[model samples]
Target: MAFLDIDALVGLFPGQGGYRKGALASFWDEGDPVLRGVLAEIDEVALRVLGTDIGSQIFGPAAAIPEGPELFQLAVYTVSVATYELLRVREVEFGLLVGHSMGEFAALVAGGALTVAQGAEMLCHRIAATAGTSGGMLSLSCDVRRVEQILDLAAEPHVVVAVVNGRSQVVVSGPEQGLARIGAVADALGLPAVRLPAPAPFHNDLMSGVRTEVVKRLGRVRCAPTRTPVYSPILGRCYRGDDDLVDILGMHLVTPVRFDTTITRLHEAGARVFMEVGAGRTLTGLVKAAHPQVVILPALTEPAAVDTEDTDEPVDVPSPQPSTTDEEVMAQLRAIYAAALDYPEDVLTADAHLEAELGVDSVKRIQLLGRVGRHFGLEPSAVNGIADHETLGDIAGQVIASLEASGGR
Candidate 1:
């Protein structure tokens, strides 16, 4: 299958603003750009909602911001909305929908518990409200029972279970001191633990301030019935109504996420494909570790070979693999673009106008620009003016013009 404009999905991850172009190119080359496109799209949303560099702070692109106590909730909403959009587009059949941390919101959105625009607005509200607390979260690979015992023994302040990602992986959160205590405990226990690059401690008591605000926001929005099966990390049951969505979403902001259990149960129920819809392969990695027998796919990931900081890499270019012949090159380019668009190839021609003939709307044009930029090594910025190209032949002619400008083939 030809690559879809996957790089466009970077709008999903918040911390990845610094590497957008490089990230998109690498994503396209990975042969699975759907996830990339979803992530890019979500990142765009994050920038629009939080302004400035909120996404960077959340994803460790920079230092964490003090969002007061509601910071956790804000983080959750951002991640959730991204996932929601991915699931909304495919609506693929699955035995269960599982989310890690704030990803539960995505599950709810995918299962039809919430509307896309509503989810986006809610995420905005969450981030705006939670910009108060300064904290972080940590993930540990250890025996859950032992970890719980250690938590009890240490009795640290500002510490709580954030997520149970697997039998061996548990995410903990709270204040810095409490997290430090947990880390010390984990070290003594011989459990491998790493502090997550999050802005605030999520799924912990420190986020109590987020609860009232989240509830108030929930009151302002009406959830719809779910069209797909969604397993709640809080209730540990399948939910299908607005009330359930509200309850789960509200409680999830404070409750520990049981993603491990949710995934296990889903697999047991016969779910084979686990698709990480928006941003990063964090969930996919966890699922693979948790269930080695299960097949998991991440929508986006950094290709190991690509250097994210290399600006010299062709911008907005397509895959570098050359076509067999000149005619084949143009035909293949058209095929790649058609497939990238998920549009019919029969509707396209070398001289066909992208806008007039292919009906390349603005959104699609932007998406195409992302692909074309990758293919040609051209970095895509907001193009200021319409190019003079009125046909595919015109586009090809421009490519030749650019190559000639650089004294090329």
Candidate 2:
């Protein structure tokens, strides 16, 4: 690849929720000093701060994704900094750097504000501080204006508009009840809404207290000015030498991530090429959604076959307008049943009966509910109750109702 002009290559460090085991296998296989040295420091920090060799949790094979949010954060931070180091050695000069949500720490490290170990330790501290919140995040496929309408529709809204990732995509985080209400309203408007299986409600008023804990836990660590211009979307500013790092990072948990605005500002500053400098293409896809004309790069997107497995992403039903058609909802439902039953999606129509037409009796439903419930993140009772509803549309209603009554995001 030809080197882009200086200050033209924008490094976009991703924040959270994209993890694949052994994502760094390719890098490790190269025995590159940059990757090796960064991971070594991070492992020491993990041992001192988190009491586990997260290196194994990160580099080893996985039967499952780590349920703990801390491991996920640490892994992403490690990969982002290591990848940036590799690029730096190859003489790929970054025109600018931006960290998305969790990716801020990585960017901070890459920009020389924090050492690799310091970044990992701080991230682990964040994962620990993020626990015990009463709510989770709900992702929506609508624009910011629609979110205000949804908030007004909910009686005594408890949720806060947390993230505006793309022009149309918004994520709200708050109490479970508030999220439930928001989800119901979004569904009625034909907007795609799904509760993220996140442990806590972050980037909202409820998280304000977490700031104190982060400052307290930062302990001996210190922040320096970045070698490269490091911009934070959550803070909506660039990190400076004299700025209070505590105030910036602490407030990150409480303030919404203005990713959309940050991207706009970055683009205005002449950052045309955006690179998701970590695992997963989530930020890549989001960047595309917001600005299709800009260049997007991935530091290490292709997973090595050595010890990684692919996971299915949640399917989104395309609805150009606010209201969902019966057909659109059925499309998503059909994909679910088809995957579990190993049947073609064409066979799973709205009017098809689970028992009479599809031959899914109570006994069969008991088996099918497991797979279906996992897909929707529903409880056994919720999934089993869905089986009682006959037609595909009826099952769809039950699923929506479950989302409405759900207390977890």
Candidate 3:
């Protein structure tokens, strides 16, 4: 079926492990112009960096996708960008976009902060930056809370949660000893821990040196203001105009991504339609777990591979926050926004649009939020970290968090 959705659509870009050969078989067979153009732009940059175009590895009649980490990453980036372009050509009106781990590079391109060629260039630099680093990552089939227990059991200080994909998906990064300790603990706890064939520990303290190298190398490729409104789980906020793009992108090398929170935030922001515009269905599956009520689409019409797990237990889709405090928070937020906008509190419903229906612009939002911040004594960072202006409920959750956090202070 065609990916047709009128609701607020969210486009997801999955990272590293989301690649497979022949991902774009149908697109190539159909002679898609948009896909061709995107690949051409990336090949020009890839040829200069790797001495051969990435297109030669992913496309054409006789393509041999290399087993090396660098090549797999290149293919993932290329396929993701190309897939995004194909969707854009089809006029898929994505209301919000997000990237998982390294997939943020492609999201930046879609968000207009980076060009397609620049995304590919940054990926190549990323591959080069961590080539010499050591250690590995292990995926644990349990929630982050359970993973924390494993970490405590392991007593490996360097071990850290590198990626929280969903309720039951977590990947930790650390040195070999740290990883071994965690694995042993996980085995003891009866939780499955699969070690990745990662030559370098990603998004952990071990990447501290590599982070600086990334910033220096990508000094020429800073992300100029984003236009498409992208939320970064790694950064824990949307890309602000004043954000140090090069630095944030650099820091991501060592910063873990709270992707489960990203999905929850997007769902709060009035997004009920989602699609994974990449090479694998991993992001789609994670989205399904986070917001089971929302509609989700696969990576493409024909994907080379689909992500799977070997667990015996069935996946449990989590329900929304059932606490009475959450209901109170939403009601309190409606009153706050209603009073600020001079609208009747009854009309300031959860689904009320902040921009289209309420006529609140970004500038007006900043000014209004500044007043709310002073009135509630909310933290400046909390008021400023608003990711999107889609609905009152979207900003409500963040504001409520700020209120709760600053209540004691």
Q: What is the lDDT for 182 in model 2?
A: 77
lDDT per residue for candidate 1 within 296-377, as digits (tens), equals: 5554344421111101222232344422334544665576556654455664677654532243422234344445545655
Model 2, 195-295: lDDT tens digits are 55466788888887777888788754667878888878876777778877766788888889988887667656555677767665566556665666777
Every model: Cα RMSD to truth:
16.9, 10.3, 18.5
Candidates in order have lDDT scores of 0.52, 0.68, 0.71
User: Which stretches of model 3 miss by more than 4 angstroms?
Assistant: 1-6, 303-409
lDDT of 3 by residue, 119-157 (tens): 888887778888878798877767899999888877898
TM-score of 2: 0.72
Instruction: Name the weakest run of 10 consecutive residues (lDDT summed) in model 3.
Output: 309-318
Choose the strongest candidate by TM-score.
Answer: 2
Q: Which stretches of candidate 1 lie above 4 Å from their native place?
A: 1-95, 242-244, 297-409
**Which of the predicted structures, 1 or 2, would earn the higher TM-score when compared with the native?**
2
Better of 2 and 3 by lDDT: 3
